[model samples]
Target: MDGQLMAFTGVAAGMVAMPGADFAVVVRNALDTRKAGVATAFGVAGGLLVHTALAVAGLAAVLVAVPVVFETVQLLGGAYLLYLGAGALIAVARHRSAATAPSAGARGEVPGPRPTVRLGTAQYLRQGFFTNALNPKAPVLFLSLLPQFVPAGQPALPRTLLLATIVVGMAAVWFPAVALLVDRLGVWLRRPRVSRALEATTGVLLTALGGVLLAELVLT
Candidate 1:
């Protein structure tokens, strides 16, 4: 059991370290505000809890068994990603336009307004939650990975929960560390040009991931 626990921890750590949609979202939010980033991290952890519960209850197996159900979830998740990506791009465009637009002065001179980006706590949290939860892959991953560590004839639920807790705990630790690290660089990232670039890059990556999911559904 100890060996299995160690193995699971190592694997989970690797997964947490890998940059994925969750990482992208967290970094993006963190670049904007440390609080937003931290909130997003917690939201991602919340999503993991949901996935863990589904796996423990064996509901994830049903998703795998029913192609239609799985495909539907994939489509919804893909659409959500697309929406977020497109919204980000649109926001950037709007910001740019606003920045360039002429502003009236007392002497009839015009000046550009400073660009700004703000996301409420609930919004960022929701974004993080959905980004992680909607992936469909997360639940599947838990379903696949957790079983390997469970001893034969042992109660699966307790073991699964224990393993899932480890995974979530790792994410909680890793993501906030990332947020803090990024926060250290916040001064430079807050610059208009750098901020816009980061936003665009994150948006593109998210959109691309969404496209891949949708393509997989179509092809498979």
Candidate 2:
């Protein structure tokens, strides 16, 4: 059991450290606010729980067996990424417009209100959850990876749950740490030019990722 657990932890840690859509979303949210970053992290963990449930319930096998279902999930996930990317780009445009426009106050000298960042807690959570949940690769990950660690005589479901729990815990730790680090840099990153650049970069990356996923679906 100890050996199995150690292996599981190593694998989970590696996965958590890998830069992917989840990491991108967390970094983007962290630039907005620490709370947004944390919320996104927890939401991603929640999505993992859903994946774990599906894997344990044997639904992951069904997905793998059905090509259409798998492709549909891929398409949906890709579309969501495109949606997020477009929204980010739009935000960049709005911020640029606001920066260039002077406010007309009573004295004609008051500063304009800062653009309200729309990343509320629920939005953060939903973005994270959908980003993680919609990816067909997540289910495939668990389905392929968990069985390798199951002890020969042990029940698969319980063992899979235990391993999945380890992954969830690892994500909970790693993402919050990322949020804190990014938050520390918020002072510089929040500058209008820097923020716009970051936003644009994130938007481009997400859109490109979405395109790649959709291309794979089409080619396969």
Q: RMSD, each candidate, Å?
A: 3.0, 3.0
Q: Estimate every model's Cα lDDT from 0 to 1.
A: 0.84, 0.85
For candidate 2, what is the TM-score?
0.89
Candidate 2 residue runs with Cα over 4 Å from true position: 100-114
Tens digits of per-residue lDDT for model 1, 94-188: 76665565663334654333254687999889988889889879878989989999988989889988988998898888888888878899888
Give the poorly placed runs of model 1, Cα more than 4 Å off.
99-114
Q: Which lDDT value does model 1 have at 87? A: 74
Report residue 54 deviation for candidate 2 (angstroms): 1.2
Candidate 2 on 1-220: residue-level lDDT in tens? 5898898889889988898888888888888789998899888888888887888888999999999999999999999998888878888888777666655343465343335466679989999899989988999999998899998999988888888888888888888888888889888877778878888888888888888899999998
- The ten-residue window of minimal lDDT in model 2 covers 105-114
What is residue 66's positional error in candidate 2, in angstroms?
1.3
**Ten-residue stretch with the least lDDT total in model 1:** 105-114
